[model samples]
Target: MKQNVWLYIGEKIIMFVLSIFILSLIVFYMARLAPGDPLVSYYGDRAEKMSTEEKARTMERLGLDQPIYKQYGIWFKNALQGEFGLSYKYKEDVIQVINKRAENTIWLGGVSFLLIFLFALVLGSFCALRENTILDQIICKLGTISSCIPPFWMALLLILIFSVNLGFFPSSGAYDIGKANSFKSRVSHLILPLTVMVVSHVWYYAYMIRNKCLEEIRQDYILLAKAKGLYVHEIMWKYCLKNIMPTYISAMAISVPHILGGTYIIEMVFSYPGLGTLSFESAKYHDYNLLMILCLITGIIVISCNTLGQIINERIDPRIQVSEVSRYGK
Candidate 1:
């Protein structure tokens, strides 16, 4: 039976609004708790030497003189209208500065995400097929080691090998912004960071996929197919894959947030130009606006991915989805 799309949309809208409210509250309190005062830093070392009248004037101009509730009301209003307010550190609109860096970060994340998906899907399937063979044994060991190493440690190791010792890749920074070069020049520079990021993402999901595939192979469907004279390859390529579809997509979707929020160490170690670097610098410099905005962005991305994964898994297996709705709706 057809359900009400409007009802679904209404529910989603409510959830979205509530999420924004919760995020704003958390960000506001977290910013307040963080060390240092934005005002003192904004005015410079001579902030204490400034007159009360001068200080009051500056606070009034920035709207910081208002009560906390009133300040949040104004900020929330503007934020809903797409005006994110000004940054004390950059002396520019917060959204504008963030957008500039967001483009590069999104691009890098997207490319790395694709590499991760492809690597995990192909190599994971191959490993599953070769289970109990030397190839599978080697892959399992390697994956375990790769997964065991922390992302930061891997990043430092890469830096030591590629940047510090060999000097093959630039240690930090994006590219020569002004230097004229072919399209290849920009892409080549991204290889090292992208490689490290992809490897980190790939192994986690690949192991999950391997385990999912193995479990799927034990299902009665596989036994039925095998008893029907199906080839082992055919059973794996078709039945086993179909069975593990949910697990694969779910695992991949879960990684989306990690990839988005992570890269801090990688960015810091490699000095890559991305949100990770921006967040680090903002926190170090006590740029409250930037720090809060980055946190908000990261939260939104993670929540969005989780919601997407739920929706997708439900759609792919409507029996479970419908059961869930029925259980909750009543």
Candidate 2:
């Protein structure tokens, strides 16, 4: 068992390394392929008028004169050593730029994730318990509609309703500029964006969980539990929930990274000072180093969460054979 666990972990580590390498290569190439020069973001209109010699000197300074493979090699080596290069646009270390914004993103994402799960759990379970009832049908329709609506559009509608019409909630910005340092002011500013995030995500998860619950509830084991005279709530909570946990964990793991990434749009809509906002600005200004770091961070988050979720699922359900999973993947 210990040997299998170690082998599973070793496989995951190998996969992680390979995924990072491939993702880093793609990020490097995509940044280069994108239109606009980093020098333009650095020096603005002056870049267009610079002489060939000046351009060459500037490129040399930024190491842009190096061959593409050489540049990637240097970047990969530096990244391995915890040295993400400087941000040309920010005039700061890549880490510093990311750190300044990461906390706000974490807070926003964390709150949104918690709300999504909590709400999904309650609504999903209730709908499943009341399956085929009017309430279940209503919730199902609502989930369908919510899934169809784009998140950005929902964000706009929320801003229009709550911030504009209702005279509540700030439409944009992390906090009022004058009271920016106050925790209360920041929390007030977060309400609209947080609501937008939660509303946009909750229904789909709820619907999915509801269906999973309904399916599990109809299983033979659940029927057997009911025959044994177990309480409905006990059967749902203990048997049904446990059986569907792998699915729940898998979904959460897959979705968390997306939630983190989705903050780019949400933060942009609200002008919140988070990783998403930072990412938008970085891409807009052609800040390759900053963008690269963001991509790397996102890749790590997704891969780490997925691996962790799989490990937890395997531990919880010993029936899941790592060797079988590996063979299936092959």
Candidate 3:
């Protein structure tokens, strides 16, 4: 068993490296193939006046004149040494740019994730227990409806209601510029964005969990437990949840990067100062270095989450085979 586990780890490392290599290549080519050049964004209004010779020199200086394969090699080599290159738009190191913006995202995304997960688990279980009842049917219908709504639209609606009409929350920005950055004010700014994230995603997760719980409740062990005089809620908490946890962890981990992707729109709509908003700006300006680094970091997050998910799955349910976990690639 130990040997099998070690073998799985080796395979995982190889897979992760290969995945990163492929993803990086795709990101590199796609960014280059896009319509505008970084110089346009960098030079802004002055770009059109630059002569052909001047543009060539600028491209050469930025190494954009290099062959595609050569550019990839140079980028890969520099990346290993922890150099992600300078951002054309920011005129700063890519790592520094990312560092400056990551904290706000962590705070916003973390709180939203916790709330969604907690509500999904509790409410989903309740709905599953009362299957066929009016409450279960209503929740199921709502889940289906909510899943169809775009997150950005929900964000806009929240801004319209709470921020524009009621004046209960700030419509945009991470914090007030004039205030002393009190927790109360910061949280006030967070409310609309957080609500958009949680509300948009919660019902979908609950729907999925409800189905999983319903399936688990039909298993023989649950019936046996009930026959042994175990209460429905007790069997659910002690046995059913234990069986359900592996799936929940796997789903959550795999969705982390996607959730971050969703945050891009929400953050942009709210003008929140986070990685998502930063990425949005970078894309608009063709900040190649910054955009590529953002993609790389997101890919790494996905790979790391899948690895953690597999490990946690094995710990949660020892009966889960290594073969089963190995199939769950990010």
Ranking by TM-score: 2, 3, 1
lDDT of 3 by residue, 12-119 (tens): 899999998899999998888889878987788787899999999999999999988899899999999988999888899999999988978887888888888899
lDDT of 1 by residue, 64-129 (tens): 788777777887788789877777777788788887777668667888888888888777778888
For candidate 1, the 10 contiguous residues with the lowest summed lDDT are 179-188
Report the C-alpha displacement of residue 196, candidate 2, in angstroms. 1.9
All candidates: TM-score = 0.88, 0.90, 0.89
Residue 201, model 3: lDDT of 85
Angstrom error at residue 59, model 2: 1.2
Off by over 4 Å in 3: 1-4, 178-181, 227-229, 310-330
State the C-alpha lDDT per candidate.
0.77, 0.85, 0.85
CA deviation > 4 Å runs, candidate 1:
1-3, 40-53, 179-182, 220-231, 317-319, 328-330
Looking at model 1, how many pairs of residues clash? 0
**Clash count (model 2, backbone only):** 0
- Model 1 scores a C-alpha lDDT of 0.77
